[model samples]
Each structure stands twice: as structure tokens, then as C-alpha cells.
Target: MREAFHEQLDGVFDDLAGICRSVETAVRLATQALLSGDAAIAEQVISADADIDKAKEKIEDTCFQLLSLQQPVAGDLRVVVSALRMVTELERMGDLSVHVAKIARLRVPDIAVPEEVRPTLARMGEVAEDMVCRVEQIITTKDVEAAIELGRADEIMDGLRRQSFAELFADEWAHGVEAAVDIALLGRYYERIADHAVSVANRVVYVVTGDFPVDV
Candidate 1:
């Protein structure tokens, strides 16, 4: 009976890991679609969102089943309960990626980013993507140290977000309001990806230590 329960727990872990990887890919591919104005890629990201949702649902259902059947205690309970919450954040991250891709598709053949802001957007995407990857590692390895450090990592994304906003709101800004809105929304999407990644790390800390990090 104990072995069967552990197997079920292991299945939940595997499913959660798959979610982390999928959202990471979504963010990266959305960035590509944004930069290149590739409708095809953007469409692909939009469609791939279904898979992320399905993964989250599977984890949530498994968590509910475990909580009901196995009645996990202490660390096991933490793992099951935290997973139910973490998948919400992960799903939102996936949605943010879809938001980014929708902008690319909205503009169709035209690149969503203005030339002056391309480098900043690129940096935002890279940092946000890396944050997700790091969060995944923290979740799998239960690295409390990395989870604590995750907040510091978010600073890079915040900085880039500020830079993007500055360009859009600058007096010399030539892009019209329509373009300005796109830049603003796109920057926010990247920033939010990092934010969710940090949230994931926070939940990971809770799972491992039974306490949320004060800073992360």
C-alpha cells in the first residue's frame, strides 16, 4: 500500500516537472514569434497552451486524489498541497506566453517590437526564460538555496522591464500610441513570466522547508 502511494506521488512530481519545461518553451517560442513576427510560431505557441493546461489539470487531479486517498502527512502533505497551488502559477505563466504570442499574431507579418526596443525585449525574454528553467531545477532538486536566490534573479527582469517602459514613454518616442501599447504589454508579459517563476521557487521552498522564504 505504501509503495503504491509513493508511485502515485512520483507521478505527480513527473507531471509537474513536465509543466515547468512546457512553460519555459512557451515563453521562448513566444519571444521568437514577437521578434520575428512569425505568425506560424505564434500560432504554435497559442495552440501549445492547451497542453500546458492539460498538464496542470492532471497534476491538480492527482493532488486531490492523493489528499483524499493517501492522507499524506508532514512533508508529504506539504508536497501535495503546495503542488495544487504551484500549478496555478505555472498555468498563468503559460497564459502569459500565450498573451505574448497573441500580440505577434495580432500584428501578423509585422514585428511587434520597435527596432529601438528589440534588444531590451530580447534581454527580457532571455532572463524570464532562464528564471523558469532555474525554478524547474529548484523544484526537482529541492534546492532551498536556489529558491532563496530566485528573488535576486528577478531583478534582471525588473530592470529590463523598466528599460522597455522608459523607451516607450520617452519624449523622443516615435512609435505611435498603438505601438507604445504593444511594447508596454509585451514588456509586462516578460516581466510577469519571471514573477511567476519566482512564485514557483517560493512554493518549492515551502515544500522542502515547510516555510515560505521571507524574501523570495
Candidate 2:
């Protein structure tokens, strides 16, 4: 019975890692769609979001089953509870990617990001992608230190978000209010994605050490 329980737990982690990879792909493609004005790609990201939601639902049900049948305690309990929380953050990260894609779709045939701000937003996308990738590693390895470092990557995302806002508010801005709003919203979406990644990493720390890092 114990062996079977461990196998099920392993399966849960595998599914969570798979979901993270899917989200990473979604954000990367969403950025491409936003920059290249590819509404079709944006549509793909939007459609893929339903799968992310379904993945989260499936994992949550597994967790409930484990709690009810196995009655995990101590470190095992931490892992199960943390997974429940981590999946919530991962689902939100997926939603943020969908939000980015939706903006791309809304401005079909015309890029939502102005040329001057494209580089900043592009960097934001790269950071978000990298963070999610690291999140997968932390989840699988349960590296508490690596999880803490993920917080620093989130700081870079925050800086890039500020740069995006500065460009929007700059006096030289030629883009009208509508464009400005899109840029602002895009920056927030990317920043929130990074924030969710950090949240998941911190939860990983809690799973490993029984306490979340004070700083992460």
C-alpha cells in the first residue's frame, strides 16, 4: 500500500511539471503573437488555456484522494498541501498568458506593442519564460536554494515592468491613450506571471523545509 501511494505521488509531480511546461510554451507563443501581430497564434494560446484549467482540476482531485485515503503526515503532508497551492499559482500563470494573448487578438493585424516598447516587453516575456522553466526544476528537485533564487529573477521582471511603464508615460510617447493602456496592461500581465512563478517556488521551499522562505 505504501509503495502504491508513493507511485501516485510521483505521478502527481509529473503531471504538475507537464502543466508548467505547457504554460511556458503558451507565454512564449503569446509573446510572439503580440510582437508579430499574429492573431492565429494568439488564438492558439487562448484555446490552450482550457487545457491548463483542466490539468489543474485533475491534480486537485488527485490531491483530495491522497488526503482522504493515504492520510499523509509531516513532510508528506507538506508536499501534498504545497502542491495544492502551487497548482493554483500555476493556473493563474497560465491565465496571465491567456490575457497576454487576448490583447494580441484584440489588436489583430496590428501589433499591440509600439516599436519603442517592444524590446522591453520582449525581455519581460523572456524572463517570464525562464522563471517558469526554473519553477519546473524546483518542483521536481525540491531545491530550496534554487527556489529562493527564483525570487531574484522576479526582481528583474519587476524592473522591466517599470521600464515599460516609463515608456508609456514618457512625454515623447506618440502612441495614443488606447495604445498606452494596452502597454500598461501587458506589462502588468507579465509582471504578475513572474510573481506567480515566485509564489510556486516559495511553496516548493515549504514542501521541502516545512517553512516558506522569509524573503522568497
Candidate 3:
């Protein structure tokens, strides 16, 4: 019975990892489409988001089934709880990517995004992507160190979000309002994505160490 339980737990972990990977791909593709002003790519990202949502539902169902069938204790309980939380975070990340794609499609005529802000936006996306990747690693390895590193990446996303706001409001106040709003929302979405990734990392820490990491 123990052996069968372990096998089922492994299956749950695999489903969670698969969901995370789908979210990471969706975000990366959405960022690329937005940067390159590719409407077709944006449409594809939007379409792919549905798959992510379905994946989330499947993962959540699996977690619940595990909880019902196997009376997990200590670390095992943490794994099941974390799987549920991770699915929620991954789903939110997918929705954010879809939001970015929507913006990209709306701003199709103006292909050239502001040169100054482009770098910052790119960096934000990179950090978010890195955080997602780290969460995947943390889940697989149960590494508290890597989970802590996710916090650092999240700080970078926060800094970029503030920087984007400052630049948007500094000059170009009249003509740049709409563009600024779009950029601001994009930055916010990226920041939130990082936050959710960090949450997943924290869950991993809990699973490994059996204690919640202090949120700093």
C-alpha cells in the first residue's frame, strides 16, 4: 500500500510540473509576440491559454483525489497542499499572458513600442520567466535555497514595475497616456506573475523544510 501511495504521489507531482511548464511557455510566447508586434503569435498565445486553464483544472482534481485517497502526513500533506496552490498560481499566470496578448493585439498599428521602455519590459518578462522556471526546479528538487532565490528575482520585478511607472509619468504626459497605461498594466501583470511564482516557491520550501519561510 505504501508503494502504491508513493507512485500515486509521483503522478501528482508530474501533473503539477506539467501545468507549470505550460504557464511558462504561454508567458514567454506572449512576451515575444508583444515585443515583436506579431498579431498571429499573440492570437496563438491567447488560444494556448485555454489549454493552461484546462491543465489547472486537471491538476486541481488530481490533488483533491490524492487528498481523499491517501491520508498524507507532514511532508506528504505539504506536497498535496502545494500542488493545489501551484495550480492556482499557474492559472493566474496563464490569464496574465492572455491579457498581455490582448494588449499586443490592440496596439497592432503602432508596431514600435517605446525604445526606452522596451528594455525594461523585456527584463520584467525575463525575470518572471526565470521565477517560473525556478518554481519548477523547486518542486522537483524541494530545494529551499532555490526557493529563496526566487524572492530575489521577485525584487527585480518590483523594481522594474516602479521604474516603468516613473518613466511613464515623467514626460509625454498627454500623448503617452494610453501607451503608458498599457505599459503600466503589462508591468503589473509581470510583477504579479513573479509574485505567484514566489508563492509556489514558498510552498516548495514548506514541503521540504516543514516550515513556512518568513516573508520578507
TM-score of each: 0.95, 0.97, 0.93
lDDT of 3 by residue, 82-138 (tens): 778878888888899899888988888564357778898999888888788778877
Candidate 1 lDDT over residue span 166-203, tens digit each: 89888999979998999888888888888888888988
For all candidates in order, the CA lDDT equals: 0.88, 0.92, 0.82
> Model 2: which residue pairs collide?
none
For 1-216, candidate 2 gives per-residue lDDT tens digits of: 778788988999889998999999999999999999998999999999999999999999999999899998988888888889889889999999999999999998899998999999999999999999999998889898999999899889989988888898889999899999998999899999999999988887887778878954
Instruction: Identify the superior model by lDDT, candidate 1 or candidate 2.
Output: 2
Deviating ranges (above 4 Å) for candidate 3: 172-175
Segments in model 1 whose C-alpha atoms lie over 4 Å from true places? none
Ranking by lDDT: 2, 1, 3
The numbered model that scores best in lDDT is 2
> Model 2's lDDT to the true fold?
0.92
Where does candidate 2 have its weakest 10-residue lDDT segment? 207-216
